[model samples]
Target: MPSVPPFPRASSRTHSSPVYRQRIRHTVPAAGCLAVLLFLIAFGSSTVSAQPADPAEHVSSTEPSTSSLSSPPQTIAFTGGAWYDGTGFVNDPLYIENGRFIAERPASIDTTIALDRHFVVPPFAEAHTHRIDQKGTLEGAVDAYLADGVFYVANLNNIPAFANPLRDTLDRENTVDVALAHGGFTSPGGHPQPLYERLVDRGIYSDWTKEQLAGQAFHAVTNSEELRTAYETIRADEPDLIKAYLMFAETKNASGLTPAVLAELVEMARTDGLRVSVHAQSANDMHIAAEAGAHQIAHMPPMPFQHDDGEKWYLIPDSTAQLLAEREVSVVTTTVLADGFDDGERKERVRSIQRENLSTLHDAGVHLLVGSDTWGTGQNEALYLHGLDVFDNQTLLRLWTDTGRSIFPDRAIGRLAPDHEASLLALTCNPLSDFTCVEKIDLRIKQGYVIELPPQTTSSP
Candidate 1:
């Protein structure tokens, strides 16, 4: 294996900085499988306790809570692991108090987990997905994400009626944190319209008709008047961010939102203190979205499957890449969706295009976020990116850790340091040596609370 990079030390007290060593003498245990030991350090002696209850029942908000008999320990220590500092790992003792990482120990220790010198990294995040918006399907997605160590998710498309009522079920310590872009702005006959229509045809939404799903599934607007009214309606619902659709906006007579309308929407979202994330299907769509000052491009342009066939419309030009970087816009790599191309030659061609586009965007200094547009978690997206050979193991790890910024910019997450969220994954091996080690998480922690799961039937990372 190649050598891991040196741990970059912090220059100041910022939470973004790497760990500054503070050695404390303690007896180190022999190497063994990770073990959970709860100790009430109020007095001199230690006491053992059973595993904590599900964190969902204890925490209602993002804030940490005091540990009760039903909740996990609030003041705890995770010792004997190589903690990832967003760049490299360092052997250290990580202390948590009140669901936040603290540099020093608290007055009283509530619990301790011995990692046995495993590799610890920040919890994973999914920057794009539409799976966690339904009432009946939310629990399954949450369980899958937690089992995969994906602590954060960004639901890029949803029906407010179906998704809004279920917001209270997530963003807690037990469940994965979520940000919803309810009912994206699209043309009358745009991308997601067809997708939802198909679902309705299949009986997934047995009650709703195609006419009723128009505004409920997506907001359709053509002129400035419709755009203004639609924006107001969505803003009243209070989405985490705004979602816009631009399908081949640069192409002549394209059936999507125009640049003027998208630009206006971006301005409105900014005025309301919300960011705009645009779903762009082609290179022209991406360019237009960036020019309109959209905060994020939901996907890297994929090869056209149904429309605009027989042309490399998805290939991003150098000038557009430069403009995207200049605009400070982030792009989510949903390149894994291209794997469904059944034709061997077409699949390889798409792969070549994907490799070139990823290289171009990375070279232009554009921020690339990891996201699986499928029902799966971000782990699959990271693995697919690895197959593209566009990024190495270290780069993939960093991108996965940094995904929280695109979903929740104000909160301190996607890093392991003082003042950051107390959430992480402890793997059995070094991911720097083998990227697949990320799937081998032995323990998962979120908000100073331990997340216990049933035995898995699948293979390890």
Candidate 2:
């Protein structure tokens, strides 16, 4: 069980919905990746079940025990290959059991299916998303990224009342595994003040009050006595992670937790076995949280993060950036927010800006994760949060799948390695090369069942 930041209390009016958000194979010296993928698809459809599904359903969690896999899913052999199975550069002779890899064959030649050929990167992960559940019922937004090879999502449960059940359902189904935060706690008038205030006014939430809207209630403990109590209180619930909103986003006088307070929170949380996700947008706040040893920074602000210089564009000072890199603190850029609008090309321009920044962060060796804080209305419909070229479905898929897996290493996401949970995607093409191929997602297999693809039928030999 992990404790996370609480979602901004919204009005009775619901905010965002999830329904948004690839592929391929190998060849002989000239057969091409597409050819190999087609062969594998035809072969796989022979023994496996590729059932039609909602674009957003979670995958199965069961890993075929070595016992069950004595005779595994039919293996496919492709050539001229490129793969990322934790081990780089695998040329053909790869085995795909169910959807997980089985073994590799050398110098391929046998069947129509190909494996070790085309680039086979791992599936993507969505570090910060509010996805729907398997039941089609809703506590929060649903995820529509299944067909695109996004194997897992780090859904933020800012609203436990709604999030807990959804998380439970995912676990029960062994569907898409979720690394979740219980809910973001906030001081009554904190960043979410407006959203929370609206909900109360609309009679949507009964526990509405200005005081409860602050940032402190959600994270900060005023004194040592409260500090100990806070740790125990959170400990009782047993959480996988803890998140803190250190800033006062909407206030006329925006503020953040004092350095001392933030330091205390980090220390206390670490002792209690909790990883921290700090919501710090500005460089000042980001550096502070970093110094305090926060594990991940929630979002990159509209501008580059910088020190006290106070430039118009948000920027991170060299020193702070270096420190963050050295500490290996991951920065999750939820570029979707800034790029959500289509205001006379304004959104597109913002998307461009984000691309440059994201690329820089990536080059800097900063573990950057793609997160579309697709909260609020119509957030997921922007075509691609961080997809193709700048924001296409392809880029989005890889970013979330392969890119996001590292965020939670212990979870073992992104690949179909031996003894790993069976999370895979069978798209129309190999997503590793042209992300655009994710648009070709013909099947999305979770544990073993095909999730969002058309049902597979036996094909004529």
Candidate 3:
């Protein structure tokens, strides 16, 4: 057992200077194998010790508590593997027990199942996936992630009602590390207005083509009281973090959250101990969110807003960079999301916008966490392609795996250190040397159970 869990708070940490990434190190827990049907059936359960019932009944409580408690949770160990060691990825032996890494060495491990001659990377995490839950049927789409080495997620807005079932599965089955947001905090009319009926109307404009929604982004919040109430309602769900809505510049009818209102929402969330993430479409919204002291800003500001008052749209301005550095606002670089092409011209525009923003922020020491929003295809998954130029493959893999560790400070997940989560993916070639190697997974081990596919087999139907 670890003397204590790492609690560095991976949300985002501002650095004094730019730092390149290293490889990933972690053990696969049951959470990593949620999609592996074979693994679940073979090693679904884990046993955690319980306090003795009473001195008279159990005496010293030293019976090891085997029976009644169920089988121990499965944990996978990757021996003779190379992965990120925080500063970079390296080849090393790894050991994991009960979903956590307990040890790693330079030589062979005594385990029967060895991950020799494989490139083990941390289980990938889609930081901004839509909400998912288990229905009664075993054939559900929830496991889509585990099949892809996704152990953790930052869920987008979904019904608060279904959080429990997913949480139960994650807790009991060790299937996923899910951090959900209450249904989105949007302007009176935004993305939610279309996806959800109650949220529509108020000129949210559902009739728009997919190109419009994709270009426009989510709704913008106009009313301060409504923003306050919405934040409260979502906070009541006890989410790991808060989601905020910023307006699209084109939606003049959609009044963006003013600095005061954004501050109000931030304050309310503060009292309740919630971190805020803003879906800012422009720089003004981005500024409001930062000024309000929100913890995480979800996107890279693309174009400059260029308000009549000289305010700009979305961008990581030098001033904003300085401010973010000062206030510690970590930006989730979802560049992959920009891959959507309205057409040849629009696709080029969006891609260009993302590239500009990304290069600037990266150079500015902004806390850049690599996320795809990929699980749902909002942004495609990262391997050697897509985000390669902006973020090197090695850097992307490291941040995707380690940065999602918003819960702990550089936990065992991001590095191949002893006593970390044994959640790993093995590649045919060294990804550190070439990011594309990640695209060629040779083996995957999540919490002691293999998905049983030839390195390239599908984990899903």
Candidate 4:
């Protein structure tokens, strides 16, 4: 395979920069707003453990418990707003106690936030991103993601040595929540191996040898033994999910995992209680992944129809669509990157095929999730913006909210329900009316900690 372009890297000097600099843009209120203060009071008095809990039990505790008279859980009521609770919108008063929604309001409310003529929905998730690397660090990727109203992100392509430390640091610092696939399984000299090799040559990953980088950074398994070793190595990292690549053999020089191997990998992942997300770019590979029982397809496959030069084009076949739906495999629609393709007849043709592919998958009853697959930098903040061109407002919203919940089902995200996390985005304009309204976030509430954003400034004409 030809050497891919050198991946961006952060200078060693950049690593010494204060981490606080990354979060400087976010203005944390000194005493917080009424809602936030109430939340803190309730959270402090509640019995909810700080550690992770089962999703079904994420709601407020009902068991009576003695607390100091000076610090009782405060009841806060949010009235006069339309809430999108994942499935539909409802205009009602939502109550919160101990950082969780409650069905009934307390006899006496401590505070109330007037939300008249506003829309409240769960913060979004970027499901198929790859910005957890060093370069993204310098770019303030995590902070940018949070500022964009993304509460959670799945780093699909990860290098354990690099990703795990970064993830741990972020977790300890209470930054953003990230679901990681700590290095995916790929065939020998496969899709990402060539790219990773380039990064090493550029001195980005100079510390590790090529063999050490393989499998951990980009697995290049050629047989069962290699696959076994790679799987165990990745498993040691305790990944949230497992990822594998399945590209057509003829399309590129690098060899891809065969259907049999892919199936085995899926079985291994499931046996270990992990979900598998396969990277497949063509109908043939997609079919293999579906049949192998992969839980998610990282990208929407190219249309089944082929051009005269053998490039795949047009919409996917009905059979494939039905199989995908039956398997209940969600597709992460990462079509935003396609916009970077050089403008030409070929680009338009590919774009048309991709648009049709996503629409057909959606129509086929397959869950569509949003992902930018971009570096989540200032320049790439438009990840969620461009998708509006192809999908309707409601569909895109669901992709960003509901479908994303499927990735980390145990987390209290993607919904505004009793026990769900209090992370939410408040907008003056209803997104259902015009999705662009999402860009105008009036307030961002994450884990009940509110951060009021500064008003957007329009560029001078």
lDDT top scorer: 1
User: TM-score ranking from best to worst?
Assistant: 1, 4, 3, 2
Query: Whose lDDT is higher: candidate 3's or candidate 4's?
Result: 4
Please, what are the lDDT tens digits per residue for candidate 2 over residues 148-239?
34545665534444445455445422234566665443333454446555755775534546455333124335455655565565555455
Alpha-carbon local distance difference test for all models? 0.76, 0.47, 0.51, 0.61
Model 4 C-alpha lDDT per residue in residues 1-461, reported as the tens digit of each score: 11112212222322232221112122222122122111222222223233233322322232111110111224456655578855556765467665566677666444345454557778777778777654335225545555566667788877877777564334211245677887778776777888777878887764766767765777767678888888887888888898888776335543578777888899999998899988876766777789999999887744222233344523577678789999998887766565566556756676677777776787899887777676642123233334436676666676777744776787767778877766677666577776766655555666544443332312100
CA displacement after TM-score superposition, residue 317 of candidate 1 (Å): 2.0
What ranges in model 3 sit over 4 Å off?
Answer: 1-78, 104-110, 131-140, 171-174, 198-232, 248-256, 303-312, 374-379, 383-388, 407-412, 447-461
For candidate 3, write residues 1-461 as lDDT tens digits.
01111212211111112122212222222222211111112211122122113222421232211112212333333434445555454554555554566654323221223334455676666566663532332123334454455566776555555454455444212244667765666655455555655323333333434344321233345677566555555555667777776665334644445556667878877888777887776765666677889877776655222222222354457777767767877777666554443355555555665666667766777776655554442224464224547776555665666665763333545555566655567665566666655445544555443433222223422
On a 0 to 1 TM-score scale, where does candidate 1 land against the true structure?
0.86
C-alpha TM-scores of all predictions: 0.86, 0.65, 0.69, 0.77
Instruction: Give one digit per residue, the lDDT tens place, for model 1 in 157-240.
Output: 888878887777677777788899988998998878999999989877657788877667888999899999988888877799
- lDDT, residue 252, model 1: 74
Q: Evaluate model 1: give its lDDT.
A: 0.76
TM-score of 2: 0.65
Off by over 4 Å in 4: 1-75, 107-111, 134-139, 169-174, 206-211, 249-254, 303-314, 377-390, 452-461
